[model samples]
Target: MIIGTAGHVDHGKTALVKALTGVDTDRLAEEKRRGITIDLGYAYAGDLGFIDVPGHERFVHTMLAGASGIDTALLVVALPEGIRPQTREHLQILSLLGIEHGVVALTKADLATDRVADVTVQMNELLSATPLAGAPMIPVAAPTGQGIEALRAALLASVPAARGSGGHPRLAVDRAFTLSGAGLIVTGTLVSGRIAVEDRLVLSPSGLELRVRGLHAQNQPADHAVAGQRVALNITGPRLSRDMVTRGDWVLHPAIHAPTDKIDARITLLPDFRLGPDSVRGPDSFRRMAPGAHALRQDAEVHLHLGAAHVMARVSLLDTDRLEPGGDALVRLTLRQRIGALARDRIVLRDTGATRTIGGGMLLDPFPPRRGRRTPPRLAQLAALEAADPIAALTGLLSVPPGWTDAAAFLRARNVGADEQLDFGSFVRAGGLFLLANTFDRVRDSIVAVLGAHHRAAQELPGLQAERLRMALPDRPPVAGFRGILDRLLDQGVIAQDGPWLRLPAHRISLSPQDERIWAAVMPLIAGERFRPPRVRDLAQALKLPEAAMRMTLKRLQRMGKVTEVAPDHFFLRETMAEMAAIAAATADADGLLTAAALRDRLDNGRKVAIQILEFFDRIGVTRRSGDVRRMKPDWPRLFGGGG
Candidate 1:
């Protein structure tokens, strides 16, 4: 369990830590000389690890970096000073970051022995509304060891249970340096997942692969580390140096290495600023703005802090143009550079000048679309993502417009493990895609509706072409996903396919009596030599029929779905086309590529006819061709009857 110290500066936070763990967290000479903490420092007590953060307002960003992954906060408030500005600000920050468990420490009790009771009452009032409302408050003075044992006992009792190691490993690097013998070392809190020696991970925002050579967990040498612990990793990578990594970067599994520049989130604007007892804002700073100036306007530039990294960002209000103080709304943040962020990661927003904390909230969607963000459907999506239950969130997303979600991305964003058990209830899964069962039914019905309309409008045509039918749908799903829907409909006998055309299974066309007579003679001639059907000129010569007449009759047969035009003047029977497709499918290599010569060898047909057959498949989306090879497409099984 990790415990982080939070309170105002010069409040004996560092001194109290020394009394508890006997390790001075302020290791830098500058910090020692200045009697302040400039960066994060760590100390350990048995199973408990404490992150001692700076209490000064200017180093709040650094403090936030250390506080992000702590399980319990050790709120430090000096007795005589009561609750200072940094104390209140840090409390608000801890609340925004979702810290639930904590213990309050009233430091400097020796100097203000008479005021301890009054300060304790004030602390209780402040804690009454936050997550740690009923937590215990202890007074301690490090100089005289007053109440030191009581505070230590309180901290030990506040440690949360060990979290399950069922997520991908993600260590938010707050410190990076190189040792003479170790090469490179990065240390931070293991927020989730697990890591072990020899495990390969990626350093995000840089895309460098790292191999963990050694590690320490909670100041103890260990072979493996789990979530909710302070972890230091000695790693090596190609072209890797300490400079390539920084405090804000992430060392995580490659599967979770997505760096995004734009995010959709739920934000709460902090109410009008109230100057604390000891005001720190400079004279020129806008500590006192006009009545409504604090309202955040649309496209307002601000500083965003996540983990230990801070960058400039522009806020685009989704629900309102001007968000009044203390108001809540959905928003979009466009960052100046990509950050390794994920869903539910807490973020803080500061003024453009980076002087004052404006507001903060939880991130919803890290890879939000660039446009249509303000639409009603998108707002619904944001609301769905806010749900704590994964199933509830997925249901909301799959029930909205364009009712489908990428299954892998959804699970990854939620940090759900592959082994986690979740009951999605009723849904349709096509590879990595997921959709509501009702949505799948609607899409299937839409496909039949589109084909029925096309068949009714054009009685002479066999059916609507596959690509045209796909474009006609309201929810234009990707080609691979659309094919899955078609396969389902075809299997249920709700729809039929002919070459690359789709139609209702009941739809059919009748041939004219005179045209039927021409088709009767042409059918046998083509069917006799199925694999290598004769061209129009050869058929016309054999029947002593007019060349134009033979061509017209075959063209009419083609429209009726009886034959397919393999070339300009050549055609094949419908059954013969299915047979050839099966042959090509069987002859193709593992990568799905087949040479024309290979097809010729399988069919025992001449090379010219083989090329023509393959070319015909290419035009109908059954296969794609390169210089001398053709690869069967995902829709190959749907070419004749429908299965793929």
Candidate 2:
């Protein structure tokens, strides 16, 4: 487990660490001369890794960088000072990051021996509402061996067991440097998954692939490292240098390659934060404004800290126009630069000046929907996401009807199981749209119901057109998703597709006795007038049938491929249209160009009939029309079954 040190400046945090581990964490000359921690420092106690962070207000960003992967916090307080401003601020930060397990060390016990009882009362009041409210407080002094062993024992008992690396490997680099013998080394807590020697890992946001040359767990060389352990890795790859990999960068598995610039989160503003227009007017105005008068209004610019990365972002409130102090709301953070993030990752939000941490929250969706911000459906979805696990949240967002998402987005945002039991292709169909297994089943059932109704209503028709079938469904999937469902159903022999229509596998068009009599009369008339077919009115008059009945009969024939409608009032037999196509192919020149007059002369037809036929050819991609002349398309031979 990684133990992080949190406290104010000159609180004997570094001195207390030396007493327990026998190693000094302040390695910088500036820090030693100044008598304060400057940057992040590390020390080890057996299997426990101590991340000793700076206690100064200015180095809070650096402190946050180290706090991202810590399992427990060692909150240090000076007995003489009791609870300082930095101490309270650090506690709030630890609470924001959700660090629950910790031990509060009351340092300088030797000097404040007579004040110990009073300081303990103050410490309890300070931590009453924080994450470490009930944590044990031990007094220790570095100069003398006072309560040092007790502090150590309290830490060991309070720190939880290390979690196993069950997901993809991700190590956020808090420090990167190069050694003479070791090419490049990156030190950080192994946030998740196991990394072994020679395992290939990619640097996210840069997408550079590198191989692990060596591993060090808790200052000892090891062949493999697991999650929740502070580790150093020697890395090497093409064009790789220590400068390219630095603090705020991530060494992650290749599967997590997508970087997001927007995140949906549930945030709570710190109670002491002011809420009003004066808060955002400027730094001068903010300093002049009353503490409780300022608010974090919508569209306010701020700095977002997640993992080890600090980015500029704008806060867009989802449910409200502004957020009051201590009030919680759903929000969308639009980041200025992309970062590697996932659902449920703890985040801290700081003011634009980066001076103080205003609030923080849990990331609910790393890639949230871009529309319907204030709508009920969108709000409900976001609320559900806040209460769901990573896998459940992913499935819920993907299962929403009628859109495709980036496959990499979903895969990268998932907190677990990229290469485990989840089959991405199974739930997500082609075109990168995610469909849950249950969603696919629901769509399939809807299709079956729509087709069944169509068969009952229009038995004389061959089947419903594919486009019509899609429109008939009450809840339609995305176009590609619908097509994928059709393909699956066809492969399973649950449905049959004929040309451009779909039907049940056993469905076949059959006319009733009355319709069959009407078909017999209509067939003879259409066959005799092959080239110059009668209109609906003329056919109805000749057959002594209603025009509506005649038009319905002609439509069924057209669907059955017995007749073709070339224009609004024109009709032709299938054989006649085929003959005309053959004649056009024979008469056209090398360019496949022909005039309406030439076709009319070839078929002994009027100008009106020739024009209609040419238009029909153009519609089906058989021919291209230029000026008054028509030219067969490049693929006319294949479409018309004619020699080139």
Candidate 3:
């Protein structure tokens, strides 16, 4: 387990670690000269790793980088100083980061032995409403070996056993340096999974691949290290330099690839959070009022801290425009830079202008739905996601009305367990830039119902066009999203497609009994005319039928592929069009070029009808017209399934 020290500056946090482990964590010359910790320091006691952080106000960002991944905290309070400004801020930061187990040490006991009891009372009162309210307070003096052994025992007893989930390994680099003969060593707490020597790791945000040359756990050489241990990795690779890999970067498994610039989260304002001047009615009144008396207005700018990454962001409250202090609200954070983070990761928010921590929360969705983000349904979905487990949330989001989602985006936003990912692999289907699943029966059923209605309404048509079918659906997804669902349906044999049209797999175009009679009567007249068939008005005149009826019958025949409409007013049997195409190909010269005159003689038809047929060929890509000559396209033979 990793234990981090938190308290005011010069409060003996580093001194306490030195007394317990016999190693001075203050390795910097400036830190030694200034008599204060400026950066994060490290020491080890047997198997327990202690991260000693600077307690100065200016180094809070640096301190947060260390406290982000600790299992427990060692809050040190000086007996002489009691509770100071930084002491309260550090404790609040620890609570915000979700550090539950810790022990508060009243340092400098030798000098203020008489005041230890009084300091302990102040410490208890400070933690009364915080996560560490019931934690044990031990009075210890770093010098002269006073209460040191008891402090060590208390830390060991309070630290929980490390449980490895066997997920992908991720290490947030806190320090990077080049050691003699070692080259490019980075130290950080292993957040999850395990890493062994010679293992390949990828540095995120940079996307550079590196191999682990060596490993150290708690300052001792080791072949492998697991989660919850402070480790140093000796890394070597091409183009690798100490400057390239720095603090706040991540070394993670290659399989973990999702990085995001926006996230949906559930945020809680601290009780002492203060709104800016713009949010208040009067500046004087705001200055006189106590903290936690106001609410965070919409579109407030803040600094966001997740893992070791610090970024500027804007908050958009989803449930309400104003968020009261100590109240929880679902919000969206638009980040200024991309960060490697996943859902359920804890994030701390601070006011941008004041740099004081306002609140912290857990990431709900790293990639939220861009459309309808502020709708009531979307708000409800986010709430459900906040309440569900990772696996359940993933499945629920995939089962949305769209029935498809970007695989990379969905996987990146969810922190799925290794076991759950392995179990649910088959449930997710991949098609056309999306991860599809039939988990939502309603979406599937709706698609089938819509296709059935389309087929029933247009019985004479071959199938419903893709765009038309999309419009008919209740929940109209984007074109790509609709295609993904259609592809899945086609794969399942629930739907069939003919060129640009979609239909039920069992659907077929058959004329009704009444229309079949009309078709039978019109076939002879159309076939007799062949290349120069009668127009709709001429056909109705000859058959003594209504013009609308004649046109409807011809349209049905066209849908059945038994007739072809070469021009606006001309119609021909399918066999005649194929015959005309063969004649046109035969009449071409060695260059495979023909003219209307050549085809007119071959078909023995008028110039107008011949020109119409040639233009029809051009429209279907069967022939290309240049000046006065028509050239046979390469695929002309396949155009009508006939030989040249």
Residue lDDT tens for model 1, 1-644: 89899999999889988998999999999999999998999999898888999999999889988988889999999898999989888988888888888999888888898988898889899888788898898888998998999988888888777777877999999999889988899999898899999999999889999999999999899999998889999999987888899889999998888899998999887775322222223343223223226477777667788988788787888988778878888999988899999898999887765556778899999888777999999999999999978888889988898898888788878887776677865778864578898888888878878888888898888897767898999888877677777777777888877766788878888888977887788789888989988899999998888999888988988887888888899899988998999999999999889999999999999999999999888888778999899988875776677565
Best by TM-score: 1
Estimate the overall C-alpha local distance difference test score of candidate 1: 0.85
Can you write out model 2's per-residue Cα lDDT over 1-644, one digit (the tens) per residue? 78999999999888888888888999999998999999999999897789999999989999999999899999999988888888988999999999999998988988888878998888888889888898998888888989998988898898686686778999989999889988899999888888999999899778898999999988999999998888899999997987798688889988876688999999999998743333344632222223344576677777789988999888888899878889999999989889888878899987766778789999987888778776777776677667545556656665554423455566667656455565455464644456676776777788889888888887766677655788888876656556656767777888886544578888888676887888788877877867777899999999888898888877777876557789975678767777788788787877778888888888877888888998999887678888988887664543332322
RMSD of each: 4.5, 8.6, 8.7
Worst 10 residues of 3 by lDDT: 280-289
Between prediction 1 and prediction 2, the one with superior TM-score is 1
The lowest-lDDT stretch of 10 consecutive residues in candidate 1 is 273-282
Select the stronger candidate by TM-score from 1 and 3: 1
| Alpha carbon lDDT at 245, candidate 3 | 80
Clashes of each: 0, 6, 0
| Stretches of model 2 off by over 4 angstroms after superposition | 275-292, 388-411, 418-441, 452-472, 510-644
Better of 1 and 3 by lDDT: 1
